[model samples]
Target: MIKRLVLLAVFVGGILFTSSSQNIVMDKSNVEFRVANLGANTVKGKFTGMTGNVTFDPKNIAKASFDVCIDATSINTRMKKRDTALKGPKYFDIARYPEICFASKTVSRTGMNYKVIGSLSMHGVKKEVEIIFNSSRNTLTGKLKVNRLDYKIGPKSGVFVGKQVDITITCVVE
Candidate 1:
């Protein structure tokens, strides 16, 4: 009886540690985006105040996952007027949808990095996206492309802003 109890405890502990949740280093985490304007110039911006829960284990690749969100109102383009405009109805519409969130559905190994297939929710739209990330040390850096038109991100099309947006997400978790 004593041996069976000890074995059960060991198995439970192993299950718990197999996929443990980690805290995001908020100060060191952020999301960046880039969009081409008029086919000539590129407009770049970043969003801060990101928070997330991450469970990652390199040895257990299939068990790793990420659930994260970035404050949409935190968008900064280095121009005050442009930032405010982007927060309005035609762009991010921060008043209604204040958060851009991603929840992992599946994780798979892809070369030296990993591919995270997930649902990206923003601007009241939810879409499946694949984020390929390279883990180094304690940080996870992921990148993906978002279609602005598909997400209803902007009112203007290629005339003023490009349809595709480049996004990069960085997180350091403990």
Candidate 2:
């Protein structure tokens, strides 16, 4: 009947839309950062426990959106002492603010890649940041530089830990 045909079309459209957007697979995703440790060496770390929703369709970039949150206490530098300090009051202060989040305001294509302008909230401070990323199949990789001082991650006047932190995100959606 005509009514059944309409219902079938609607159901198929819904399924197609749902298939385009995906939730990040935490076990397969990685968020890593690198920062200069004093005048000695570079400290590399990674955070686990990321949760997010991503809606991306190359043909419909106007409707793309990204929203993600990383667990603040999940910082792991592979060095217990450093990780503990970073979780303390002078740094992330995870006891107070336990999440680092980002919500995109805009997403646009640049050449073969895309850039997302969003508000990155961390260490109890929120700042606007731009992330450049590449998408291939079911994976997305993004990179951005974050100024620790801007987020109050460490002492205001000290440079024991470099201010600029390079963060890379590799996410697989399912």
Best model per lDDT? 1
lDDT of 2 by residue, 117-142 (tens): 99999987999999999988778899
Which regions in candidate 1 have their CA more than 4 angstroms from the true location? Answer: 1-18
Taking all chains together, the TM-score of candidate 2 against the true structure is: 0.88
RMSD of each: 4.4, 3.8
Q: Which sections of candidate 2 miss by over 4 Å? A: 1-20
Candidate 1 lDDT over residue span 1-174, tens digit each: 999999999998866754698789988999999999888999999999888789998888777888899999999999999999999999989999999999999998888989999999999999999999998988899999988988888865577899989999999886
Best-performing candidate as measured by TM-score: 1
Report every candidate's CA lDDT. 0.91, 0.88
